[model samples]
Target: MTAGSNSISPIPVAPVGLSSRAQRFVEVDGIRVPRQDFRRHRDGWIERGIPVAEIDRAADFQDRWGGLALPPAPFYEGGPRILNAGCPKGSGAEGWSFPAGAGRVSMPYGFMIGPDGAFGIDAHRWTPLHAGTDGWVESLALAAHATRWARTVTRIRGRAVTSLDLGGYEPVPEVQGVTDTWWRGEDSLIALYRGEAVGLDAPQCLEAHVYEGLDEWGLHGG
Candidate 1:
């Protein structure tokens, strides 16, 4: 059955108001289900090493407290893939509050959407490294890569960033009329890539910036 079906197969879950159509909406796509429902479904596709929703309850962790004073300690990356990881909390309806609900996982790095890894974030936006090439094709390509990075990041907090230009030894085409606008929203950061904002492609070494630095462009290859 479609994921939005309220009738959970194993057992009845607390009232999940999402209709099948609503489940497919952009808004509900990243929400965190109650802690219990997450567990039952996690095992459904474990053979592929997919993580179950076993995370520290959102009520347990505070928001991005300590601001920059802290080490942006909400995320971690690179090794020891834990499929049954926690949810990513910061902003959004899923954040603990009046809507006191579950939507965050204690994932230090962040989250990947599909079990197959079609799209996701690893904490790096490349505005700082694409200098001199402004209004250029390489710049737009980089913009696409970075915007994709921001949208994919599960947690809004910051994370360690590492970039390497894997698209090497090959010639490429350049596209004009591409630009991006990186902004900080009341709750979440926003990227207007593609039409206005964009990101860099794979393998290009880039830098990570805090929300404060989103607007400024760093030198192209520092």
Candidate 2:
């Protein structure tokens, strides 16, 4: 759907592989695009001289999709809250950081685009959430997609999570990250851990939510 001069269009059905029930689009520059698209709102990054190269790298996907407005899941509230580009902390040798959003509590940490073109959380240190912003977006999309089709969602916590034998599950490449990860099996999907644990330097906070009873369509929506 498109947006007019005065009125924003109603959110259209999410793209085929995304979850329609999980997210709605937000208006950007009077154009209705997915909330994940941060293109038009990236002026702050440019003004800060955040290296065109770095901005371009993150924009590869941010231009097309913005962050998701997902339901409460793990450490985040309303998913990764999308924000305007800003260098809350001045750019350093590590490179310029554009504040993306924050966790549910909004304290100690928030998301950002780090120097090496990675999308990560900034707290005690920069903890990479994904190799790139595109990965983060893909991760959210997958989560919503899987949850929508899963018959049962089982959330597990603590040491028990690390013990799950994912013998038949394959890692989901789109949602690539060390601490937080997604795995897919024949009839189920496993979302392991949340980045907040690592970002906040609290390993004990790890958790996993399993989505079971998903068919091929659910696993990989068209």
Write down the lDDT that model 1 would get: 0.25
Note each model's CA RMSD in angstroms: 18.4, 5.4
Q: List the lowest-lDDT window of 10 residues for candidate 1.
A: 64-73
Quote the positional error of residue 53 for candidate 2 in Å.
Answer: 5.1
Q: Rate the local accuracy (lDDT) of all candidates.
A: 0.25, 0.61
- lDDT by residue (tens digit), candidate 1, 41-70: 335434434322312232122121000011
Candidate 2 residue pairs that clash:
35-66, 36-65, 36-66, 36-67, 37-65, 37-66
Residue runs of model 1 more than 4 Å from their true location after superposition: 1-37, 52-180, 183-191, 194-222
lDDT of 2 by residue, 53-152 (tens): 6666555434334332334444455445443234334456666666665555656677777766677778788888787665665666676677779999
Task: Return model 2's CA RMSD, one decimal.
Answer: 5.4
* lDDT value, residue 201 of candidate 1: 46
Model 2 regions more than 4 Å off: 1-9, 12-74, 88-92, 102-105
Backbone clashes under 3 angstroms, per model: 36, 6
Task: Indicate the TM-score of model 1.
Answer: 0.17
lDDT of candidate 1 at residue 129, scale 0 to 100: 16
Model 1, residue 59: C-alpha shift (Å): 14
